[model samples]
Target: MWLNGLNLMDLLVKKLFSYPGRDFKSGRDTFAPFCKLDAKLNHPHSAYRTIHIGGTNGKGSVATKVAASLMREGHRVGLYTSPHIFDFRERIQINGQLISHEAVHRHLSHIFEEDTESLSFFSLLTAMAFLYFREERVDWAVIEVGLGGLYDATNVICPSACAITSIGWDHMEVLGNTLEEIARNKGAIAKSGVPFVAGPSAAPFFPQAIHVQRHNPYDLENQEIARAVLSTIGVHNPKGLKEKPPCRFEWRGDVLFDTAHNPEGFLRLLEALEYHFPGQKFYFAVAFSKGKDFQSCLDLIRPHAQGIFALRGDHEKLVKPEELNLPIEETLPEVRPLVVCGSFYIMNLKPKKGRETLGDWESDDGILSIQKRGE
Candidate 1:
């Protein structure tokens, strides 16, 4: 654990989560506290060039693709995303490498030493990523907005380029009830005179954006947005454009994993599935966070799924299987092409090592624990 049984990384995570406004779910009064914290840290985000991306969906994919393409172009790139699947360190990366545990301890420990009592979990993490990127001297950093843009912690930087991948019904409580309102919040990332690119759906909100035409198979649209975003940063033709952020239509054996927590995202994902595996009905395992329109999400899946298993996750915000009012399975059926979607937290379920089989999904101490390799 530690020299005296104190693991610094664990301590940091605990401390961060203990904050009053640890996440968007907790509700934030204002972004002032985050800005104050950033100022106190001497504004580390200002040290390097950044590309800020904000939207309801496809943002993570676009951000990851942009970072990967920049890396291929021989640039030292730093990528900051959110809601990590397995490890928290996945949120911060430099050239596709996760930030070292020691580095997280070093930066976050120092940040905690500051007067950060009012900062949220996302704010602290963003500051730490900015500090890490600055010290490491990355050529460019691709920053994804954790929520809506106007008041998001990552909105502190005036980036070299900005993009809004797509605007859909999500976080409507924090953002707004209408698409125009949501678009406005996400489009706020665009700075005056800075190069901006956006998908067609969100382009109307931002007058400055160079609109990209819509592409079927949602991932292709993400790729096009990434390409247009890269062109703004002087990268015309970069490689690795096909690489996706974790958990977006990711496949392990026959199980398909996706982080399509909202109705719009689920529609896109299902459409992609229809295109890829036409006329095939698949089993589904799904759960969603507290604030989401879970019913709408479920409605979209019901028609396409052969069978559906309601799941719960370790996170406090996740809806329990019983709450979903759907059949719960302790061990998934030996069904091929099981489409696991709804939330990123479902990714914690993994096949056991050696046996290489999906078996025995258990709930212990509020953790929807699934036994993995060597555990």
Candidate 2:
């Protein structure tokens, strides 16, 4: 093996997973290491304004919309999200472009060279994104919280604005067993005197934040938050913001790709499904990662599903098909309007091609087309 650029990048990514990161157990003290790394990196995150988004659901959508809107307005925007579906580079992008493989290798080399101790996978990635954005001289960065907000590695930035899309009980083990705890953790992303925008339910958690007025369409509420965040930075007209990120109710012919892993997310997904296709029942292909309330999510859609196709996801923590107590199918159904739901890992599942094949389902670049904001 010559360890070419591509090989080096893959090796660095593999080494990143070996660190004591999100996959392993650690205390709040784990966050302290990031501070040292940031200092050594010269606080690259401070070079540009940041918009922080955290919530149980809709945070990624809101982040993407905000980034897209900024990008369309001619600003060099960097978007950082988590749990990439296919590519590790998807987690960091500037103006909808994935970070180059060489950039990843170069940054990883620097981090390893300067490191006195090991950093978490997320911490290293977060540092790499901050460094890349700063080096790229991006005008703005939209960062999405990977897990709970309070102690998440991405929370180290002092954002120009903060938004919490919605609060729900999902990560009870780490984020507390109640909604209040989760809300507080998510709301902790709010900076002092920095304009904080939150969805109606999440408003109570951020006492000083402005609440988005509830709207009929669930995504409208997410857009409202993005608009509010833009307003704080004097960018009033967020043009071209209507596009939804990949896997948020995305449709390929009749099969829907949705990352609705929790109960509340499923509720919103069901609402969107109902709004678009009235009086239509769907055949569901669902999978979920560990720590998610898969059963409750399933319960929400079970009544409306014509048949349930349990899919085993690619993650190690994925809930097995047998655990779902639903019929496991090795292939996709011939039924119209098949829905692939739950974890982002569902994108990894291989669906058998039928008569009506959804066109280019896996080719999503994860960037939405530019459209007029509020369209």
Candidate 3:
């Protein structure tokens, strides 16, 4: 079967990274070619109502909750997020199920046939999601912006409603150095007549936006944004939708796993840790990808940690543990309240046998293991 063909999948990955697309650099016109591709695909993105979420943090959590809540309300929901922890298929899901391997092969085959020589990995995936959602006849699709909303490939879809979770200094080189600049870029997703909801920093930019009050418990703030977005479409009762996307305060035994790669994310993680495990200290196992403010993140969380374990993962962009200038430990203790965090690459590494597994289990061997099992 096509799903069993490893060579085909390898070829797809190669083609995905071959284009000279902007990895980090941003321009408003950067995604114009992808917009053309979507048009060629017969505008599948227009076939369903969508919710577009953009922010420095909490966007993924808000998107997940919004999709799950809609699904609970008896809507066929399509969810699209970025930087999958293990499988590429995790980026596209319908009602919490990953897109099947056969479906990926079919969509990628079609994309290649359309001359996707200039499309970046994210652009290709976004187009594939539009096609999949339309063909599947979904009632709603929740899309999280991969980067700044203005130039993100997913911006091609005119969403039914829009939200900005929170504004912070991230991707500063591309989004700009100041909070106001970042807010402007993320707030660009707002449409004239569309209902918009935003956190405090971004609320001023959208005059018509309903401001979601920031709360002490970070998840509450995210829930407020999701609730507001759902209210726009008459979806009430968003409580008890407990679909936890991997690596966001996911727990196994005593260890917690989080993809807190930036300063803002780490601050939130620290708050969660303090709330959940009051007066308890954790041993933090952390790593960061390139272009992240790792030092600031570390400094903020250091006070709450008993010790720090520096992790070196397979991804090329990961900052080596030695480079951080912290005293690095070689292995984790058999039983300790640990927090595995920073880059998703660190979470992708195999945990020691004694460590409890939580959420999605990422293989140390790489994509082949998860792809073969079709997880």
Candidate 4:
């Protein structure tokens, strides 16, 4: 991976995940693990202004944008996110750069030496991030919720602001079914005092079949969220938002990589596509997590998609292309300008030639540079 120095941090990152398995039944499980790890950060210096972002989709994007904007303002920023496309450290960054493996190992070793057995993979990793941020004395940190908000360990953040960027059907097993239910699950970051910024919603596509307790934060639309958050941050510039967090955009000649992960998210992504490359046929990389209703999401995207080319994410719950068994070949002959959407996992581009990213999780993996016609 083109990393320099510090083998210790790398070892720490890998070792941190020593405990396998997740009891994702609810937010409760998520907290317990973190609590166990938190008990170990003896220095206990958890002081830093935070920007906590949560949502089904776009949270990572918004978090990235927020961190970038903060960095542009010349603040020392720490960004912690999850499910890296490749490297584990992709999850933690300081001032716009990924932490070195050596640094990760050195930091993680301290926790390992203190208490070896209790921390879950997520918890251990989260602890490392907190330690690094504290040690570096960052001006601010952007923490992304790994799953739903309420119980997510990252929720430990006490921040200048909070953000929930769009909500929709996802993680049905934990968050519950229906948009409102899911939205509420994500909205938990809307604590009483912090400024909360939410992204736009496409409307509750589902009925009020599911009931969440009062004070559901997902109910706030993006505009309302923007107004609320702007007030807190003292930002009056909509002009700055015109560029719109590149959200998810990719390009390789005819093939475009758009990691549009869920169903409802297609609206804004498609809107972005129309603006960027109108009338292009899309060949997509589609997959659902264990909790996602794969076929339902597939059906929702089928019309807009030229054909679905399935792939997995680092989390490994993604559906494989062979498992899809859809009529992809037939659709491809007619579909122009193929797009690989839904997951970054599909960069391999299939056996057909030219859609390969030569590297693996390590940066040195060779990417399939280009595709020749009829190769």
lDDT (C-alpha) at residue 258 in model 3: 83
* Prediction-by-prediction clash tally: 0, 2, 0, 22
Candidate 2 residue lDDT tens string, 85-145: 6677788989878888788988898888776364677888999999999999999999999
Q: What is the lDDT of residue 22 in candidate 1?
A: 46
Tally clashing residue pairs in candidate 3: 0
Predicted model with the maximum lDDT: 1
Residue range with the least summed lDDT across 10 consecutive positions in model 2: 366-375
Best by TM-score: 2
RMSD value for candidate 4:
7.4
What is the C-alpha lDDT profile of model 3 across 37-122, one tens digit per residue?
88889999899999999988888888988998988888999999987877778889888778876778778888888866656778
Listed in order, each prediction's TM-score against the native is: 0.90, 0.92, 0.90, 0.76
lDDT by residue (tens digit), candidate 1, 1-375: 334324657877788768644456543554787888888889988888999988889998889889889988889999999878766777888887778767888898889888887677778888889999998999999999988988888998989999998888998887888999888888878899999898977877776689999887888898899999999878898785787865677766677778999998999999988988888889998888877899998899888989888875677778777988998755444566688888887776764344353333222322222222110
**Which residues of candidate 2, in runs, are more than 4 Å off?**
1-3, 20-27, 116-118, 354-375
Off by over 4 Å in 1: 1-6, 20-30, 352-375
Candidate 4 CA-lDDT value: 0.59
lDDT of 1 at 39: 88
